[model samples]
Target: MKITVLGTGEGGRLHAAKLSELGHEVVVGTRDPATTLARTEPDMMGNPPMSEWLAAHPGIALLSFGAAAAAADRLVISGIDGASAVNALSGIKEQLTGKVLVDYGIPFNYGVSGPHPWPTPWGSMPTFAVLDSDSLGEQIQRALPNTHVVKAFCTQEQATVVSPGDFNGGDHTMPISGNDPEAKAAVVDLLKSYGWTDILDLGPLVSARGQEMYSHLHSAIGFALGGDRRFGLKVVR
Candidate 1:
């Protein structure tokens, strides 16, 4: 499989490494190729740069966003900050047409300010940048009208997304939702290859609202877990 994993952060590099290990033709997409290649320091999250991941994977490729999208058979949209998810993909919209674009992004900002609390009147409600009225997945679909985007792997940590089976025999559920059946199936196959055994199809792309919004609860859990992200939220029924 020729796969383009977008984003230069840990998430993108992680998927690129894993997909490359699976014998797929994987290339990482970033804003600036030269800058990304010159990066000797870890990313903002302290994860080692893409160069390190590439060193371990030897043959994996890296390219600019547009070129990577153009060369790939499928796309794994990773490394997106929720607040800017739409802008991230909008640039490559034309190249993504008819491709299974598996998106793993949450629409919330992550930084030193930490999570954004709810608005004053609804202070109790979970915080988010895109919610209720719209979602990251829907926004991408709207912007890239010709692309088949499937939302998956947003609920799990980078560790969990790539290494789920390592946890207690991998009895967990990852939510996947999108409007296109073929696109969704392609993502499902990819997840299954990565050891995701239990997947829940939450219906149309609109269902992405709940899946993406779950990031609020997910953030709380990650914080509560003393920042350990090795575990996943499994449906126990």
Candidate 2:
């Protein structure tokens, strides 16, 4: 299976490495390959530059967004930054046509200043740009009507999503939602391959509202857990 992870962030790097370890042909996409490689400073999250990660993980191709999307067999994990994802992905709609896009982005409005602000170690807590009535998944689906959009991985940390078995023997639940049943099934299959045993079908892309909106609570939980702990939420039924 050929896969393309569309970002150079930590999340994208994790997925690319894991996918390659799983013996899949993986390519990473970014706005510009040269600019990404030229960066000497670490990312905002304090992770090393893309070039360092790429050097450590060999055989993974790096390409522009359009070329990466074009290279995927049928599926693409969209790790694009939430704020710019819609615009960046919309620019390559033709290349993404007829593909399953597993979107893990949260529509975070970092510039927002409200009356009551929740400040974290980094900065003020980001408010959802699209919330309650709309979500990033719906926006992407609408923008690329030809693509099958699946909402997943936003509700949990990227590390947890990739390796759920590390916590409680993979007992926690992974929730997925999308309009296309077949696309959702494909994502579920991938999750199973990653060792997920309890996956909940949240149903319809609109349900992504709850999933993406949970980002704040997810952060809050992280803070409560001492910031460095990786945890999972299990749906005990």
Candidate 3:
């Protein structure tokens, strides 16, 4: 699969590296291509360079922030910060038409102050705000009428998101909510590619409200559990 990861932060870099390692054609889109090239060249051990990486990984292409969204295929997973979420999608809504968009966005407005607050409808939870009044997933779906949106992996800590093995207990389960069956299936497969075997499908997109709220609860748990972001929720029958 040709995957274009938009963003240059840790989340973006992590996704790019992981997908690349998984044998997918991965392109990591950054805000500034030149800066990314310069920084990645030395770090990439002189492996042709970012431009070469793009050429070698033809199917998998890295694009700039705007280009990644405008040229994604099959799936587009967003991990950009809250402030840029709406603006970021503005230019690429057409490209996302009829495709599955996996939203991993948090609504917290960071520029304000302590414990960034989530956007409207997503009220305050114990620690973080309830990210979805109707739900961020639903909002994105509504905003991009042609796209199929699903909410998943928002509650898991960044550490656990990258490496689940760090957790000592049983296998961690990642919950997903989507209105489209086929789109959900595709996301499930994507998760599996990252070694996620236990996936809990929580009904349709409406369930995103609960899923986003869970992130706040998870945040509280992280604080209480001694700053270990490697924990996850498990359902036992």
How high is the CA lDDT of each candidate model? Answer: 0.79, 0.92, 0.70
- Residues 1-237 of candidate 2 have per-residue lDDT tens digits of 999999988899889988998899999999999999999999988999888888899999999999999999999999998899999999999999999999999999877847788888777887788999999999999999999999999888899888888877878888998999999999999888888888999999999999998888888998888958888877888
**Per-residue lDDT over 119-237 for candidate 1, one digit per residue giving the tens place of the 0 to 100 score:** 32223443466789888888888998998988888888877788788887887798999998988888888889999889899989999998888877776676667645466889877
TM-score per candidate, in order?
Answer: 0.89, 0.98, 0.77
Ten contiguous residues minimizing lDDT sum, candidate 2: 110-119
Runs in model 2 lying further than 4 Å from the true structure = none
RMSD (Å) per prediction? 3.9, 0.9, 6.1
User: In lDDT terms, which candidate is top?
Assistant: 2
Lowest lDDT 10-residue stretch of candidate 1: 117-126
What ranking of all candidate models by lDDT puts the best one first? 2, 1, 3
Quality of model 3 by C-alpha lDDT: 0.70
Best by TM-score: 2
